[model samples]
Target chain A: MISNPLFFVFIVVLIIWIGIALLLFRIDRKISLVEKEVSEALDEK
Target chain B: MFLYRLVYVLMPIGIFLSLLWVPPANILGDASRILYFHVPVAWVSFLAFLVAGLHSIALLIKKSEILYREAMAYNSAAIGMVFTVLTVITGSIWAKVSWGHFWNWDPRETSIVILMLIYIAYFSLFSALKSNPNRWGISSVYLIISMIIAPFLIFIVPRVYPSLHPDTIINQDKKIHLEASMRITLFFLVVTFTLLYGYIYKITNKLSLIIIKLRSSHDI
Candidate 1:
């Protein structure tokens, strides 16, 4: 329903920003997993 | 990490401010809005190249180098390539709407395309030699050479040749072209995007290190 083209851009950018945030969160979780596993291996050694 | 989270929250506000507050340029009209996103992405892409280049230099100097440092150099270039692609895409879209054509083969566009090719070649070269023991050294050298050419491609070529692209925001005289308020808006956007780039670059480098550790541990 938005007529102004700039508003469309605003919405699209918002969606893109959300998508980027989700990706960063998932990557952070993966980094945490790797950190834990490496520490555990060090402890065993 | 907290800083990273802050950028995630702040980028949206910057985007909205750019969209709602910044007035359009007299010549470029609404299409000028793309400048906020497109140019900032391009700047970050250049920053990524600089990081990779400096790391490549460090790799050459040390007799025994850190694996992740070398890997970080290459990985940052790859991430930079991603943003470079995004810049090209957004710029092309802006061009189409403003100029009524998709491909103009202007000096700036041509230079960016060449820059993209250089990054791709760096990626492909690394992939081709990744299994070899000399892979790091060889690829690092290639990145150095690419970095040498990059400044020419980015700064010199566009400026030397006549182009449809307007003079950069603050030109030689240091006089501002855009309105006073719009300058402030654009400046804030640039700052936010730079922070966005820093967050992404750090996270990506961390992830690459994680991947390296995983690979070594798995003995694959």
Candidate 2:
């Protein structure tokens, strides 16, 4: 097992960064869907 | 779009360089790694606020696409709030490691807290005026006034009072304190985080625009 505490800190930071990235990606995807719907609605008018 | 993909890749590399590649500071040691995250987020927070302020000014001057401009400014402020909170949390963590206490009330710390409060008040005022027709103008003026005060809080206040915060990147002599490798890592991370902020701001702005469109069209 890696014993250094700094390593663990790095791991924690890594996990947080990855989590933020995933959250942003999900939000972007949802926004894209909404954007498409709005564009279609505008087209209909 | 390619730039958005680049954030996913560059961010991990930035993290790696910050935590592993750069040599630990002679005094702060490994705890200094937090600098990579803290400073970048703080810079982003300021950038977001500036963008919001500029958009507010444009909204007032041009007086066109009120919803779009208001949405951009609001979204910027929202992103800025998140990053400002991150800066506080990360700074507190660093302080705990360096000072053996979390809440030191150092000048920079106090100033940042006050800055946060100012923005929080702006947000509260925004929500309270939700039903008012002059909401956009009033909030934009509030933002502009706050922007005027922001520099005093961020730069002047910190300097006017002695603090436990470390030496700034650019010291009195106008020399960078960081060594070359660390400087490079810091710059890389700052750029990557700014790009990440842009990606997020873009998405949120698009969503807000769509909402405005739907509302205007009564198509929701």
Candidate 3:
């Protein structure tokens, strides 16, 4: 296991996967705001 | 969103299984296990580019309704390029361990880099024609051209040319001789990575929509 090259790849992929998930929530919030405004505008029209 | 959540929950489990349970190939020893990670990311890059190319075609299909679609295509391409870069980086890591060097511009390496360059050129063209109303049509055509040549550039050229990269998984007669264990792990990884790609693609689309809305509202 210690000698497996794939073990390292697993570590790196996990890090990147977590990083993307962290950013997703922050970006998701911002986009939700825009979507809300667009819906509101349509309702007003 | 639910799929992505499920993928996240499952992917780590798959990684654990691969890392701890799977045995290495007799020829490749333990290093061959990197295929579990490397192949999936490369597959995602191909899928992302194809999706972008499809969006580009949609640009040509509709005359005045091209705005959001073009932005979607551009964002998808941007994400695809990111994945391709990751593919190269991770592959380089594997190369250093397996081949005793990081890079030698092997046939496979060169072909992937050429695809990257084409995408870079696409962005440059986009910037040059940003203000033109017909930019969408022109850019879409460019993407379509790349899409047409993509299979040849990525798969055929590397195999046809002599290289250090492994031969095609499918032989000339269309038979794959993948080991049963490795094949199963590959399938799992490919499905996991493809789901991850879908999540990112949707996120990119949402972000692009927000950016366009912000621009029209002068919120930026």
Candidate 4:
């Protein structure tokens, strides 16, 4: 096994990757909702 | 289908984690371990552009609004940029260890720089179209031109020039010797990154569709 310090760096990179993935997911979801609202408003007009 | 795809992504992550304990010497070296990440990034980047190119061809043929040509163009360009960066980082590190320098003007390195520039221009063209809907057609045409150029840069350029980079599998003269364990680890890495690419592409394309809808509605 690698040293604890190297292992910690690996864990940190993994966590950061997961965090970025989650952020992108949230942004996509929010964008989708905004688009739906805009489309509905346009239809009303 | 979504759950299955999610499982596909997780499985590679699991495999990669398991392989980390297997010792660096079992592969090329402590440095060879980078291939587990580097080669896959290159492979997935090429695959992304191939997907984008196919979509471009489809758009040129069908001309359908819902065909997702623009989404493919944008998303592939994004992922390609990511992988290109990964390639540079890993390649530089490997070169430092293997060749005594970080940034050799090797044929492969130069080709990658050109490849990155082409895609950067592709993305810039998309940004330029933001102010003019009438330019999408022109932008799409430019993307098609990029697709035509990609194959030559990827396949032809490196072959035509003498390269200092070692080819593990491709070339006959300078093949790096890899143990069986290393080969298996590399295979898993490629699978993992390809799955990552597919997952991101799905998410981004969905997001792009929403943005397109939003823009169209705003214009009305």
Best by TM-score: 2
lDDT per residue as tens, model 3, A1-45: 657566677788678767876787577677777778886875665
Structure candidate 2, residue pairs in collision = none
Weakest ten-residue segment in model 2 chain B by summed lDDT = B1-10
Which runs in model 4 stand beyond 4 Å of their true positions? A2-9, A24-45, B1-19, B25-28, B66-68, B131-134, B173-177
Pick by DockQ: 1 or 4, better one: 1
Compared to the true structure, candidate 4 yields what TM-score? 0.80
Model 4 DockQ (Cα-based): 0.30
- TM-score-superior candidate, 1 or 3: 1
lDDT of 2 at B49: 90
Q: How are the candidates ranked when ordered by TM-score, highest leading?
A: 2, 1, 3, 4
**Model 4 clashing residue pairs (backbone):** none
Q: How far in Å is the alpha carbon of B103 misplaced in model 2?
A: 1.0
DockQ of each: 0.65, 0.68, 0.41, 0.30
Find the candidate with the highest DockQ and give its number: 2
| Superposed Cα deviation of residue B28, candidate 4 (Å) | 5.1
State which docking tier applies to candidate 3: acceptable
lDDT by residue (B118-218, candidate 2, tens digit) is 89998999999999999999999989987888888888888888888878986797989899999999999999999988998898888888888889888
Q: How close is candidate 1 to the true structure, as a TM-score?
A: 0.92
Q: Assess chain B of each prediction and give its TM-score.
A: 0.93, 0.97, 0.91, 0.83
